[model samples]
Target: MPQHLTIVTHPLVSHKLTIMRKKETSTAGFRKLLREISLLLAYEVTRELPLTTETIETPIETMEAPVIEGRKLALVSILRAGNGLLDGILELIPAARVGFIGLYRDPETLQPVEYYKKLPEHMEDRYTIVVDPMLATGNSSVAAIDMLKAAGAKNIRFLCLLASPEGVARMKAAHPDVPVVTAALDRGLDDHGYIVPGLGDAGDRMFGTR
Candidate 1:
């Protein structure tokens, strides 16, 4: 398990998750639920952000107020499905800087190979958050982290819609310094390497296709 794995089964998250779990849920519905869950997940993900006091004027009187402390945050989407989770997270943290990393697995080796990547400036100074809908084999998530590290991202966090034990273990071994936050961690991976009870290819479900 990840050093920090908050499996959110909250009523809101669970309800939306069930709607998405149904195989008959329309592509649009799946996409929408992912967005809802992402928003809820954002609540859990940013729970520990430090706060600071600031001087501000209230409607009634001028007084000191509490506000988010430290530097602006960064969000990295592990494309292309990661983009699904990214959309909702962005809603909650609209001011957060965004980044992307696209990777594919080698046919024979089943290892990760980077295809595309673009990140925000001064990533080293930002608290980075990387997201993906599913963490099955953990290949892509690990590879995505490697890309961020290569670019000098220090304070990094991982977010996902669903995860498998294999993926969780892989992340712990590969990037223990980083924390993983997910909504659900299912039984395990399947034959072709997808989460066993997972909703299916998150990209396909969200986009409506094979």
Candidate 2:
């Protein structure tokens, strides 16, 4: 099992993230970079997945090959920004079972409120990975994982493009059993609960909305 938090330090991921943080980057460019970066982050998050060997016949001979051991993974997106990350990961693992959990932060309280949820069945049997673009306050991510556990998801992981120290700590305190994989951990959140020196509202940037 990976640690409570794993920051992906891959050079490609870092370079792309730098471009994403720029204020002048267009919506189209930001969306494109997010999809590309998610692919790299996906590679890191699934690194510790269990593996088993299986016999296979090659063109010339028969041999044993390593294969992922378990049910088709469940990828849950914490909408609506999570869709950006989910799209790229789905490209890499096309057969993965997909689901969605809709949660919006209450601006006044800075808390999460669930509006919708649709998860794959037999979550307990699957290696579930929850995708969200930012772990700014960690309120929504924690709430999402709480719902997943209630749905019987035991082997769960959280994947995000960026995180703040406060958010990471909050997640650690609330859900220590779930590991977190992120491209970068930026400075703490600002007064408005947004990460400082971080990419702006991910959903807005990705969808060309205010």
Candidate 3:
């Protein structure tokens, strides 16, 4: 319900998201749920993508069918956790370009520091979507957007599984131009900078790491 944020409320998306919130959900179950939810979420994020028609001969006759226009989209995952979301989106946008932006928060400073970034060429032309599971503190999200903007990415959208109110506010304040699409917007961040009632560390839950 927050401005500049799209909360996907499809029955299927909500159902899958409920499964992910439960602590007992196994790693495999969690991953599968995430993938399913990502597909639905992707549909919402790309709803406004520009389209053009190309005339093609059908079995019966030639017709103009709408197709996505311009350069292939750029999907930039925010390191390990983002990869999970990226995989499901790829199923829908198989030909989209892939990229990665890695950032880790310093424990003491609580600020994001970039460890790696490798993006596709012509990002300025392609519509870019940044993926991450949880938007808890929003530091990394802001930093990632900063990098994308600096790299000539003009149009960008943020996609995630869950988001905290604090994170949404932070992102809104930092980059109002970017629209955020997510399955659910949780309460807020806890003292430890974790989303309250969140599905826990997404990277750990998905990868089964301690």
Best by TM-score: 2
Candidate 2 C-alpha lDDT tens digits along 73-125: 99999999999999999999999999999999999999999999999999999
Off by over 4 Å in 1: none
lDDT of 1 by residue, 144-169 (tens): 99889999998888989899999999
The most accurate candidate by lDDT is: 2
**RMSD, one per candidate, in order:** 1.7, 0.7, 1.6
Query: Candidate 2: deviation at residue 103, Å?
Result: 0.2
Candidate 3, residues 91-176, lDDT tens digits: the string is 99999999999998887777999999999999999999999999988999999999999999989999999999989999999999
Better of 2 and 3 by lDDT: 2
Pairs that collide in candidate 2 are none
Error of 2 at 107 (Å): 0.4
- Quote the positional error of residue 206 for candidate 1 in Å: 0.9
Quick one: ranking by lDDT, best first? 2, 3, 1
Candidates 1 and 2, the one with greater TM-score: 2
State the TM-score for model 2.
Answer: 0.98
How do the predictions measure up, each by TM-score? Answer: 0.94, 0.98, 0.97
Each prediction's number of clashing residue pairs:
0, 0, 0
